[model samples]
Target: MGCTGPLAELGGGETVRRAMDVNFLGMLRLVRAVTPSMAERRSGCVVNVGSVVGTAATPWAGVYCASKAAIHAATDALRLELAPFGVHVVKVVPGRVKSGIGRANTAQIAGGHGGKPREWGMYREFTAAIEERARASQGAGATEASALARHVAERVMRPRPPREIVYGSLTALFAVLAASPVWARDAFFARRFGLNRKL
Candidate 1:
């Protein structure tokens, strides 16, 4: 989900619901869809693909961060809920996996703004920065999904798996934010990424 969105994809309502549905509800839906069978067997690993956004709020990334934070919360609860049934729940928190997800989100947001003037409040607030976030999400230094996947693959096979494993360096930074105070973290995120600059 890079850092932000186009803010107009659904054509009418705010894309807030869309973001929540995809990033939060979708994870729950998948777990509900699969957990029963695994419980019956008393064996199975459910590694949720979460994000750095789940841990801390980023500039231009409120909705995505909120939804993902819910995902992490759900992952933790589900882990305990399913533990009695012998289902292993591992949360995979990837930092910046270079994937089409970023590009698709960009295109969707960009397309949504077309024909609509840039003066729309949300668009004016987010347009250029979102474009940049998407671009940077795919750029160098962003950890590859395969690397994270390998870690997850190993974790599931282990006799004892971790509750959460952070993959990227930037993700670790977010972890620091997650543990820090609101003002400290907020100020850190706002300035750490150079978000204070003009769009």
Candidate 2:
């Protein structure tokens, strides 16, 4: 559940709303539906899949990052809330994995406006960078989906699973950035995402 576009665009609000609806509300609905039974039984685990982007906002995918951040925050809250009932809530933050998300996002953008970010106002010069950001997670160094799944499954099946599982490619780097000073983090993202230049 993600979206790619400048935050000031014509349809930006719609994009943000859709991302939140799918990524946050969708997960919340499922959790709500199952938690009552789990609470009554005094057993069960709720694993929420989040992303490294949730920890730190990136340039073009702000809305997508926000959605994942919501998941991460909710997972943390739920962990404490459901602990007394023996329900374990785990936050799975994957950095980057070989998934269909990139393709889906590309298709979504194409379907929305012919995949032409160059035509967008104020962001025209950033077309290439924006396009790259859209597919950034699907790069060559991305971890295999099977590998991530295996690691997560193994840890989760343990006698006591971790409160949060952080795995996949670039997880370490993101962790560092997440802990870095706000100014430094901002500088790093600006340079990395081609936002350092004047438009």
Residue lDDT tens for model 1, 4-96: 643344232446777778778888899899999999999888988778877776765566767778888899999999999889898878787
Query: lDDT of each model, Cα atoms only?
Result: 0.72, 0.88
lDDT of 2: 0.88
lDDT of 2 by residue, 29-120 (tens): 99999999999999998999999999999998888998899999999999999999999889999999999889877766666555543356
The alpha-carbon deviation from the true structure for residue 77 of candidate 1, after best TM-score superposition, in angstroms, is 0.6
Off by over 4 Å in 2: 10-12, 112-118
| Residue range with the least summed lDDT across 10 consecutive positions in model 2 | 110-119
